[model samples]
Target: MDKPVLPLTYEQIDHWIASLQPELAREGFTHAVGILRGGAWPATLVSHATGAVPAFLRYERATRTAVWDSSVPLPARGSKVLVCEDIAGAGHTLADCVSFLREQGLVVKTLTVVFDDLSRMRPDYGMDCRGYFALLPWERHAYTDRYRARWQHTQAGTLGPIGEDHEFAVYAIDLDGVLLPDVPPHRYDADLMAALEERDALLPFEHLPQIDFSRTQAIVTGRPEIDRARTADWLARHGYAHLRLVMRDPSRHGEHPEQVAAYKAEAALELACTHFIESDPVQAIFIAQHAPLLRVVWWDAARRAAKLIATQAWRGADAPTP
Candidate 1:
């Protein structure tokens, strides 16, 4: 349970694509097939940096429950398949993709991305520059039927550019200002916390008693590892069993130390999260691909736990107006 899921700043992780370009050329991946959606952006960055324009593939989500929709339009033959994902947690998706590529007879020689932690199998090439280390919720956070029973956004509309299909919303604040309370467990706002408590299902946990969390996600970042841990632990106790700690292990990828810092983006994208919260303005300013669609929340109060602020504001659709 002592997971080291670390959060990464966008600025701290944006340089990974350029750094990994040399690996692509060395691997002879002239035409690369990037998995769709999440992989598209990183693939684009890689293409721009390496001048490999037509070197990306767009894979779709699996329609089947058993199989992940890696709808990749791979070349019928085979070249150097670089399966890219935001985070390499457990390698479930990564491994699936590798197998999928191989089935097509397309030689998947290397796996490249911002973060590659061998949750299962090892990638031909590992470049985790973003020292950002956190447990991906989908992979670690507990799920439950009760949590799913409360549907925030039904699969009724389009994900658009924001990826609304993931059924997640954004709530952001600063570490030094908004998240820290006047007390010791000062990561969450005391007042807002009371609001969160009103609905226990919202707390991070797996296995909803009656509902299915087929599509729901969350993304949060703190100043340092300790602050993040404090908030994370508090949430877990309060009913956030679904909170995943993105742990950063140095031994995992010895080849690309620089990539360790860039893996934060992987964490953000792993949960299929479209929104984010942050205190540092610079964190989102530098990174080109990971910016935008980002809503910056200036911490009105600093509480590590939860505060009873305007609950309806954060909860949006359901939070009471009290």
Candidate 2:
């Protein structure tokens, strides 16, 4: 199945920039350098965030060489320079720049907007690419014509829009119970991992037919972030790795395990999820309050189709339960 082309907005980019500020500071980078085209904006944002001098570095990918063509010279030797780029796939170009910068005697660290899961080079900081493809905000224009036509076709003959107030909405699905067999939390073990690894060991819920995983924009789960890699691997093996996988940050809510709904709700709101297919009934209720713009649907175990919990229904309480 073809992967969905997710479009990003400037708001999301600002979130990335704000989130990366402190991490960049800890690395002690004195300068920020961007690779041509895609890298320029992110590098500038990081520089502004970190109070580092912003500069540009060009890479000749065909020759795998880093070129220093700016009229101004690079930072002095021993200066910490953070190399920035939009995305790193195979990372050959990034690796070449790192090598060249080091050869020039500059301290080099790296940052990228996103990185492929199986990428050869891992940046010091990066967001993992959930899907096989990404359409960055800067690159959105190039794909607009194609994406618009495809989106229109996909929405045709369906409801007016997909999201709460939009002309179309994106789906958000849960993994446990909905996609895979549900093992009690206490019973989730290595055996489950082995089964997931085998691909056929797991089965989709009986009621919900085999779904086109590509349709889901986000997998909002209550699992902790520490399991991200393991969860991603399982999803990838099952051909569902392209969608964004959201896990709870244990450190932030160490005392509130019951607030899983809050975590899922916040993620759904941030990711602009319009329709949600969840397994947990309590979470479905909480999600309705937090994600007012989202239409919540519970995957009823005994039902033929998903159960719509609420749509634009205002409920009391927006605060996360303590």
Candidate 3:
């Protein structure tokens, strides 16, 4: 099953950081040590808020090591310091960093943007984000398979598996008009077999949507399942074979716009996809209506733009027509 995702916006992160200011001031920290990469942002903010000297430590996750920056000389022994991190997952980075700081005789208190209940090292202060995969605004690419593989590699022999249930954004995208030029319905109606063959031969669209194929989990298409072989071949040839393809069931539904929309909506729900991108505006509206919680985006192929279709406005009888 796909993990549930908690998309964190800048406003939300700023608010979280702001909430820590009062306590940070009370702690009377002399220095704010940020773990590099993810931790640096929050550490800088903490420094700004608490008027503490900002310091950095480069942490290597794979090697489980932390090295202090050469320019920032070590703080005097016994000085109060707050270590900041973005998130405290089941990792050894925080523990190792804190241990290294304490070894210098500095008083170390850990702070993180978020920490799960199952985290190996709970921060002295953090937003309890148990069970959800918190997607940070700056590190949107962190959820990709490659990133996960790296995480898994470093986490081997750890407490729990990374694939365990957690919240994460799952994206489902349309194929025909979104990924490639759509063979007009008229052409398909005129010569179904010939149009199918032509579509199979056509290359991907030049100005496709700015979707990260690595993060995209599924492709929900209106094409019938009988065409899976050709569809899979097309996707593989175009370097998108890793994505799971959900094709229309010819035995259950016809090629009507409404039927197609329903099929796509059902597929999105079954896949637990948080976002669905469709090329047809009408179908986009229909899918949003069917799955009110699902985020739907209408991809304009010509303009190469994506417009989010809000489902709330389409909920009641007073809903505006598309």
**Most TM-score-accurate candidate:** 3
List the pairs of residues colliding in candidate 3.
Answer: 3-168, 4-167, 4-168, 5-167, 5-168
**Structural similarity to truth (TM-score) of each candidate:** 0.41, 0.45, 0.59
Encode model 2's per-residue lDDT on 206-300: one tens digit a residue: 46634444556788777778778878887787777778888888876442533777777667656645567888777787776555445678776
TM-score of 3: 0.59
In order of lDDT, best first, we have 3, 2, 1
Q: Model 3 clash tally?
A: 5
**Candidate with best lDDT:** 3
Model 3 bad stretches (over 4 Å): 1-4, 61-64, 138-150, 157-172, 179-217, 221-244, 247-300, 303-322
Task: Kindly give the number of clashing pairs for every candidate.
Answer: 87, 6, 5
lDDT value for model 3: 0.82
lDDT per residue (tens digit) for residues 13-115 in model 3? 7888888799899999998999986888888889888898899999876577888973778999989999989888776889999999999999999998888
Compute the lDDT of residue 41 as modeled in candidate 2. 90
All models: lDDT? 0.42, 0.70, 0.82
Q: How close is candidate 1 to the true structure, as a TM-score?
A: 0.41
Model 2 ranges off by over 4 Å? 141-322
Model 3: how far is 54 from its true place, Å?
Answer: 2.3
Candidate 1's residue-wise lDDT over 111-181, tens digit each?
A: 44435343455556555534444422222221122222332232323322222333344222222222233
Against the true structure, what is every candidate's RMSD?
16.0, 16.7, 7.7
lDDT of 3 at 254: 80
